[model samples]
Target: MIETIVFDVGETLTRDDCYWNLWADWLGIPRHTLSALVGAVVAQGLDNAEALRLVRPGIDLAAEYHAREAAGRGECLDESDLYDDVHPGLSALQQLGVRVVIAGNQTGRVGELLRGLDLPADVIVTSAEWGVAKPQPEFFHRVLEVAQAAPDETLYVGDHPANDIFPAKAAGLRAAHIRRGPWGHLWADAPEVVAAADWRIDSLTQLVDVVRA
Candidate 1:
């Protein structure tokens, strides 16, 4: 039985409009354009960051990130930014004595943002803090270490098949393909992605029963 449930942040627990819109402003592009970029990137099976590079050459991502942080942007999010299912789902898991962890590919500032919102997570970690990002095996290993739980006892849920499901399973943790976000809904029919998951969920609320099972 799974004793811990690890979740991805963007598009899993939180909607990314705030973060992406900030990037849109920084890039001097209309928000709708950035939205199109995202859809194109996902449809082409390209990495989101790489898609940005393809669109704008010589863009210094680190410098832009620092500039944004220094200028007090993308630092906090409103409660409306989260999916409706997030709070109840996380609450249900906690009430079952299941450890709920947020381990996702995000910048160092994610911890601060989550704390500012006081999200319901037993532990929160990010790729920046771990010095690695998914779909790296080290990232998942670190999550398991942080949770003090074995891979077999962990259920990893995320919307991205490549970054979340594949890596978690490769690292020996059970993966749940949540079909609610860009990559999730777009690639739901992909044979390999479908095969990689141990479970599939339509929403976070579904996870309450899955974890209990």
Candidate 2:
């Protein structure tokens, strides 16, 4: 049985459409360009620093993208408007007596978002604070330590296969891939990603069954 459920922040708990479109508009770049650039960065296996460098030349990189949702323009982005589905799912999980945590590559902004949303989490493990990003063994290990959960006792739900599923499995956690439309294609041709995950789900609601089973 799963005692703890850890979630990825971006696509898993929140809909990021507004954020991306805002960035694309602010940079005067086509939305597709931004999307393609992100795809390229992921495909190239660029680290966060390298990814930031590549985008900085053309866009504000972080600030402009985050300012739209965050309360203070220059300050960190707040996620007060979490996706409609996420809050209910979380509440359900809590009602079921499962501990919940968030494990993602948030750059300190997610914490602010959580506070803004009034969503209190048991623990938060972010790459910025941990000094390591997902798909890295150390990242998952750090989260596991904070959650006080063995890999087998915890369930990691995330959208990115490489960043979420791959590393979680490597660190001994049960991994689930939350395939959200076009983004799912990233893993379609990669057998390793599919093999890494113990389950594949298209929606957060599906997690209830996965956990119950």
Q: Pick the candidate with the highest TM-score.
A: 1
lDDT of 1: 0.85
Backbone clashes in model 1, listed as residue pairs: none
Model 2, span 118-162: residue lDDT tens? 664677657887888777788888878877777798999887776
Q: Residues 9-120, candidate 1, lDDT per residue (tens digit)?
A: 8888888888778888877888888888888998998887765675578889888788888887745567888999888889888998999899899877776677677777
The 10 consecutive residues of candidate 1 with the worst lDDT sum are 47-56
Provide TM-scores for the models.
Answer: 0.94, 0.78
The C-alpha stretches of model 1 lying farther than 4 A from their native spots are: none
Assess the local accuracy of residue 131 in candidate 1 as a C-alpha lDDT between 0 and 100.
Answer: 97
Clash pairs (backbone) in predicted model 2: 79-113
Model 2 regions more than 4 Å off: 39-81
Best by lDDT: 1
